[model samples]
Target: MKAEKKPIVSCKGITKVFGKDELAVHALRSIDLDIIEGDFATLAGPSGSGKTTLLNMIGALDHPTSGQVLIDGQPLSGMSKSQLSDLRLNKIGFIFQAYNLVPVLSARENVEFVLRLLKVEANERRTRADAALAEVGLRGLENRRPSALSGGQQQRVAIARALVARPRIVLADEPTANLDSTTTGELVDLMYRLNQESGTTFLIGTHDPRVMEHSKRHIEMTDGQIESDIRA
Candidate 1:
C-alpha cells in the first residue's frame, strides 16, 4: 500500500462471539484488516470460517464484541443507531447471494428504492435508475420484475440497486453462488469492469476459486482466523 492511500474499511483487533461460555461460538478472532480505496478484495473460506462475520462487521449490519471498525477512517463504535444508518446509506453498497430484489417491484423500481430512501426527487430518481440499469447491461429490461427475469438478470438488477446511490464501497457476499458457470463468469466480468472503471472499492466474500482468482487482493480464512492474505 502506498503511504498516501487511505483505508476505506479498517478492522482493528476485531472479534465476534455468539452466546456465552459453553454454548459460545467464536465467529471471528482478533482480526486486523484494511481495504484501501479502489481495491478489489475477496474473503475466501468454507462455510464455518469468519468471512461472512467480518463482512457483516464492515457493513455495519452487525457489531463486533471487541475492537473497532472504521469506515472512511471514522470509528463505528461511537456512532448512534441513526448515525450508523446514515453512514450505511451514504457510504456503502451491499449485494447478496440471493439477489434480494422485491418480487413485485420492477427492475427500475428496485433500483430506485435506494434513491427514494434518500428522498431524491422523482425525476432524478427515474433518470439515475435508468442509467444504473443500463450500466449493468439491463437497458431495455428495466420494467421486468424479478420472476420474469433469469437469475443473472435478477442479480444484475440487485447490482443496479446497490450502485444506484453511488456508494464509495461495495460489499458482496457469495454473489455467484446461485448462478451457472456461464452466468457466474458473465457476472464476475461485469463486476470486475465496474470495480475497475468506476473505481468503487469491492470487498467480496466467496469460496469460489473463480472469484478469488479475479480479485486483486485475496484473504483466506480458517476457523475464525485469517490463514493467508495476499495481494495480486
Candidate 2:
C-alpha cells in the first residue's frame, strides 16, 4: 500500500474572536482542517461567513484567538514576528482579489520582488521571474507595467508573483472578483494547471461558483464554521 501523504497545512480547533465583552464578535468557531499537498480547495460562503478570516489564519497573516495552525508540520504559536514573516516569505504564497502589483514596476520586476527580499542573486531572480511569467502565459508582457495590462493580465501577473517563489502552499482570497466570466474561467484554469503540474496546494476563499466548480475539494462555511466539506 502507498504511504499516506502528510498534510501541508493543518488547523486544529481554530477560533478567532474580535473585540471583547459585549462588543466581542466570533469569527471562527473551533475549526479543524487538513490541506494535503497538491489539493485544490475552495472555501465558499457569503460575506461575513469567516472565509477570509480563515484564509488569513492559514496564511499566517492573522492569529487565531484559540487553537493553533501548522504549516508543513511547524506550529505557528509562539513564533516571533520576524519568524512569521520568514515563514510567509519562504513557505507560503498569497494572491489577493485586488491584484496587488506595484503600479510602476514591470511584470517581471513585480514577480522578482519576493526573490529580492529572499536575497536571491540578481541573475537568478530575473530568470525565475521570467520563467514564472512565461508559465502563466505572460511571456511577452514581462516588460509591461500593471497600468498597461488588462484586468486579467494584471491578475496573471499577481499569480506569477505568488508562484515565482515556488512555495508549498498558495492562499488566494477572491482572486477572480475583478475579472469577467471568460477571464475568471481562464484564471482558474491556469491555477488548476499549476496545482496539477507543480504539486502546490491551493486554498481559495471565494463565493464564485466558477471557482468552486474548478476546485477538486469544496468546503462551505456558514456562521464562522464549516458547514460541509466535499472532496472529489
lDDT of 1 by residue, 51-110 (tens): 889999999999999999999989999799999999899999999999999988999999
Name the 10 consecutive residues with the lowest summed lDDT in model 2. Answer: 192-201
Which candidate should be chosen as best, given lDDT against the real structure?
2
Q: What lDDT tens digits, residue by residue, belong to model 2 across residues 1-232?
A: 9889899999999999999999999999999999998889999999999999999999999999999999999999999999999999999999999999999899999999999999999999999999999999998999999999999999999999999998989999999999999999999999999998888889999999999988899999999999999998
lDDT of 1 at 165: 95
Please, what is the TM-score per model?
A: 0.97, 0.98
- Local lDDT at 176 for model 1: 93
Which residue pairs clash in candidate 2?
A: none
Clashing pairs in 1: none
